[model samples]
Target: MNSKMLQRQLKKLNLNPEEGPVNKKEWQDLIKLIDVTYNEYENHLYRSHNTLNVATDELQRLYTELEAKSSQKIQVLDSKLQNIMSMAPCIIMWLDNQGYIEGCNDYFRQLLNFNESLDNKKITLSDLDLHTLQVRAEEFIKSNLQQTSFTKQIANYYFKMTLNKMVGQNKISILGFDVTEDFNKQNTINQIQAKAVQSSKLAVLGELAAGVAHEINNPLMILTSVAFVVQKHIEQNKFDQLPEKLEKIQSTITRISRIVNGLRTYARDGENDPMMPVNIADVILESLELCVESIRYQNIEITFDNQMTIPAIVSCRDTQISQVILNLISNAKDAVLPLKEKWIKVILRQVEKNVVLEVMDSGSGISLDIREQIFQPFFTTKDVGNGTGLGLSISNEIIKTHYGRLFVDHNHPNTCFTIELPLA
Candidate 1:
């Protein structure tokens, strides 16, 4: 409680050094106030110094943590970008303005079969060692410098290359995409379609087999008769009449050849044949020749109604279209065979921009429940062992390929198959 002691404490506490005289009691009270003030100042100084030390330590730790995290983030981003460049299924390269390879990804290295690092080799369009790339390098460089994109095929492999000019730099980013698998797949699909077309032709031939035999048989009988008459004329010494009989024999042989030729055409493979303007009426008549015999044998009255005398021309594959008409006529023959009053009528006419041919049979009409499904593959109303069910389906596809239509006339009095071909 002494003033001297209080002054010493105040000096230690860095407080003001001035003091005043007073009574003993007052002095004691002042001494107590100075001690309390000194104690508070000392505690505040201790706390401030301790707080600064703790803050400094924490800031150092935060700085170290921030440095570590920033480095790690940068490393991860770099790795991700490198992986993207390497894993891309394309040739990515940066070329200088002089058409020299500046940089390229792993894909480019692997594609061009570069065993060593790119730095070891001076790769340029002028001297690319790869055979395939060398052949196209000059052309590719020309197109790239012109800022044009193009597609090229090397052997069975195809590529689509794009070039982009780098802004603020004398460089171009070239991207070569491999489209070989897609191209090969498309070629495979085309082959399959071609086979399907051939199968359709064979199916048509199978349906007309019996009728074709009967057609050829009738001509054979006429030729035999003409041969016997010519022999009789020669034996009777009828020289004047020999010319007429010889003429008959020639005409009969010609008829037989005509029938055989028609059958041979229908049976030929026409999948690769080019489209041409065909006489629609002549094709119909030819189809009838192959089918009329069998139709007559089934006790079906077969009639051909031609509303157009001049040949109705349509743009189509001649033999394929004939197969379509033959298929329809064969189907009509089979359909009318089961009916008590059996008849198959053929009508040809030109309506608007289309030439229409209709084959109508006096048989039970197609049911409404199955009408929509009739053109579907393997759908038939006939017995299973007797029908392959592909006749109508193949015919429909052929007509569609010709840019025409083959459909049942639902409003007709009988089961009628109508074909509308575009007129040429």
Candidate 2:
């Protein structure tokens, strides 16, 4: 019942469509076979179309499933990120170009005592009641700087705030770290250091007590001699010599007064003194007055070379600066006292924008191995019971606090220590 069979029948009869058939039953059978063959072709086309439709539906279903899974995964990842940001210890805030608070982490909200939900409110920096922070942010936005950092105090706590501008965007991000504990610890350390400085001053005074007594005794003896001469002149009616003798007594008393005043000034606590502009040379000379007698008593030749033609002014606490100088000179005296040369030279000069002071002793330089350890606390080359070993270390710290430097001058031939402070 296929096309081949139909064709064979037509050929057997040798008939054409335009001519009549010779046998009617054979022609009728041929027509029925043709219909069956056409129906079979149509059924094949229908089956192929149904299979294609089924494949398309399966592909669409698979795409939908993949899309759902991907969306779920993305949601989970976003949730994790949010949780992490919320739980972070530091404060984080995002701001718009206009300085309005766009968003913030949970810590930021908690720090500002923001009880209301962020989603329900449009917050700005002004609403936080921190005027300093608001002003700083406004200033930063107006500035050409890309980022800024500063410390801010809130209640009893301190925060180190860092603000970064977003490149190619009108936004800024602020990060705040709590530094209260560090601040308190530093304050306590400063207090202890101050006490130590005071204690060192007292110890130095104690060592110089005998020399100070001798210095005062000389002036007193001169005063007593002058008084006796004045009394004899009065008894003998010799008024002409009285004026000269009285002048000598006045000068001696003045010397004693200077010594007493210098001692009084050096002995008290100066850590809390206000910083003022002072001529550094004057401070050095004043410090020398307190210890010059002691150095002389040891028969050490001390010389000062003042090369600075003009006054070298600096902003500092004079007492503390003087303490550092005296300590250095005292150390220099000790270093060279036993040496054959037995001399200490102090040089003051200006180098560029800094005032440099050098204390050199006529001793062989400190050993290379111990030079590095000299400035460390409790590290000393002096024999036991003779030194606290905190002198150089404290002096170094004091100079650093003044934004200056204290170190050994390796270039010098002998043992030399240098202090370099910026000119105010």
Q: Top model by lDDT, which number?
A: 2
- lDDT for each candidate structure: 0.77, 0.85
Q: Give, for candidate 1, the lowest lDDT window spanning 10 residues.
A: 14-23
Across 316-392, the per-residue lDDT of candidate 2 in tens digits comes to 98888888888898788878877888988889999999999999999778888898799998787779877878888
lDDT tens per residue, model 1, 1-424: 3446666654545233465333466556567877777887788899999999999999999999999999999999989988999999887887765666777789877765655556746667445444454434445445645465767663345888777777778677778899888878988987976666567667657766787787778777877887888788789987787788778778877867777788877878786789888888877777677777777877889999999756799888878888888878777777777679988889998888888889888976788899999898778877867666777887898899899999989898789999998888
Residue-level lDDT for 412 in candidate 2: 81
Q: What are the models' TM-scores?
A: 0.64, 0.72
User: What local lDDT score does residue 75 receive in model 1, on the 0 to 100 scale?
Assistant: 99
Residue pairs in candidate 2 whose N, alpha carbon or C atoms collide under 3 angstroms:
none
Superposed on all Cα atoms, model 2 deviates from the true structure by an RMSD in Å of: 8.7
